[model samples]
Target: MSNASFWKGVLPAITTPFHADGSVDHAFLAKHAVQLVDAGSTAIVPLGSLGEAATLSFDEKVAIVATLVKAVGDRVPVVPGIAALSTEEAVKLAQAVKAAGAGGLMVLPVYVYTSDWHEAAAHARAVLGATDLPCILYNNPVAYRTDILPAQIAQLAGEFANLQAVKESSGEIRRFAAIKELLGDRLVLLVGMDDAIVEGLAMGAEGWIAGLVNAYPVESVQLFELARDGGYAASAELYNWFLPLLRLDTVPKFVQLIKLVQAKVGLGSETVRAPRLVVEGAERADALAIIDHAIATKKA
Candidate 1:
């Protein structure tokens, strides 16, 4: 896909809805993909952080991608996450994901083991080199610990034409300006952090790979359009209300929290895989309060 064709607007990283038995509910997963597009998402991203990519096996990831491809089927593009613990693993998975009919890849850094700029760049190169599909380097220093800095991102973008975008999740909005100054349209910037969406768009980010969109895709798409269309006054009004829920995306239990909201809105279940539990207690109460308040005070 061309840069202009695939790399703009709200691309919600959708969750992999699982059955009560913890296996992926492929039927519901496909249904959710269509709903996100219907709800105004420009594209669908499966196996992303919100989808709990780390918890899925290689075959499971491919199956999820195939299911999404069949569901969305020319309606919108499906970009699956390329997350792994090593360069070779990521490249291998990228190859499989491409074969599964994904339109693009969101390449994340080597998980767990912190990598320096060169290692991070090499990891990106390996995956981009292995795939024919366009790739977006996920620069999430806060969660991944490996900061793919502006210099590194510029280097990769310059080296690989396919490395056309970066999901900037550094949480510092100034980094967006710095990146734009350096790359200056060479790389499409997608705000990876949900809380930074409005400022990121205001600063010239072309898209958002949002987690909150998994639950509130309609509002997420509306916010991105409002900001992109220069309706700042209205966007700010909506964003202020969204801020409380958007903040949940930055929390450690964001997967659980987002899934909880998804169930609350009648989209999907809150059934996460092992090692992570569903959002409950004060966290669940807090999230529900925000969702309820947003509904009660929704603007016409």
Candidate 2:
């Protein structure tokens, strides 16, 4: 796939829908996948951080990706997250995503033991070198704490043909400008921060890999469109309205909060795997209030 074709506009790192008993809810997952695509998402990302990919087994992740691929049926690209602790496991997951007929793979950095720039570059090359499908380098130093510098990214782009895009979540506005300058349109830079979408677009970001889109696809897509059309005033307005919920994702309990918001909107179940707890009492009520306020203030 070309750099422009993989993941443009609002591609939600979709959350996995689980059953009341905590099993993968394939039926509801498929339904929500269709709804997201139909609601104006340019692509669907399954088994991502927001999807709780860490807790799912290999078989479960494969099944979820296959189900999403089947549910979307080529209406939009399904990019499954290939997040693993090792380069070998990341390669295995990438191959599985490709074999499942997904359009591409979102490869995250190895999180267990952080590496320096050279090691990180080799790791990225090894993972992408394992698959023929297009790959999006997820530059989330906030979560991984290891930055993929502009020079390192340029080197990777020079080395791998399939490494065509990046999801910049470093929370540094200067980094976006630096990427645009260094890459010079050689790569597609998608903003991974919801609040930075408009600013990133103005700085030449191609699209967004939004997490809140799971709850508000319409608004997310609208923000993208407005940014694409240079309507920063309008885009900023919508973005500001969703800022409360977007800010909530920065919390350690964001994964649970996202699922809870999904449940509140009747989109998916709030069930999450163990080692992660569901929000309760004051926190839970506060999250729901944010969601409600977002819904009420949504543009027509």
Candidate 3:
């Protein structure tokens, strides 16, 4: 409701809907964006991890961002992910996202198989420097192995006013608290881990960049609202109910699990790009059962 640059609330890293043939399903993706917005997400992030950013080509990513911007049509802010392996490419993608009418950018650390934090910070600054749009630093150490430490984030935030937010996915609540303590109200703190959203928000996180929100936007937003309203007990109840489904998004086969949950909800197909196989038979059934149980329990 507010036009804050990066306030705390629910922002779904929307799953990239794919056709059965493994091509970007633009039609389904557009519809899925609308579904997420209508279901209650304050923002939508296309081309995120759940969106299978690594599997998509540069042009495909651009097209997806464009489509989401057009589909969302001002319903919610669309912050596209820019996870290129190179700094130049990341900047180029950020420009593309800006041109596509994205509200902001979520940048993951370059996946160049290195542990250079300075290089990572430089790359992030380069990307943000090139774009006038606001940027959210994505700190997913498990995926990038380069944790954007709280001090580094404070430096980045101080250096770039447009470095408006940081999505902490380190699974460390203390790290979230540390960032809050270091930066205070200077930077927007968004929780990337679904299970930690409530705790993070309780500790001054303003929003959530969640993958599970792709399938359960209503429940996710409800949890966020409860937390925002100081209803920790109620928020915990919803969170615990959805914990199993949310945990599925953390597994090695996260893309597979997200798609499976989408398919189970009849929101989209369970298709992912190559090298990332779909969960089938037992795994697929298990994921679906978890999703079904969560939905049923929440409804009850």
Best by TM-score: 1
Question: For residues 1-300, could you state the per-residue lDDT of candidate 2 as single tens digits?
Answer: 577656667888899888778899999889988888988888888887888888998889989989999999589888888888888888888888778888888888886778888788878888889988888889888788789888888888888888888888888878877877887988888888777878889888887888878877777787789878866886777778878988776667888988877877787777899888798899877887888888787767
- CA RMSD of all predictions: 1.3, 1.4, 1.9
Question: Which stretches of candidate 3 lie above 4 Å from their native place?
Answer: 1-5
**lDDT for each residue of candidate 1 in 105-136, tens digit (9 for 90 to 100):** 99988878898877777778888999878888
What is the TM-score ranking, best to worst?
1, 2, 3
Highest lDDT, which number?
1
Report the lDDT of model 2 for residue 298: 72
By lDDT rank, best first, the candidates go: 1, 2, 3
The Cα local distance difference test for each model comes to 0.86, 0.83, 0.82
Better of 1 and 2 by lDDT: 1
Q: In model 2, which regions exceed 4 Å deviation?
A: none
TM-score of 3: 0.95
Q: What is the lDDT of candidate 1?
A: 0.86
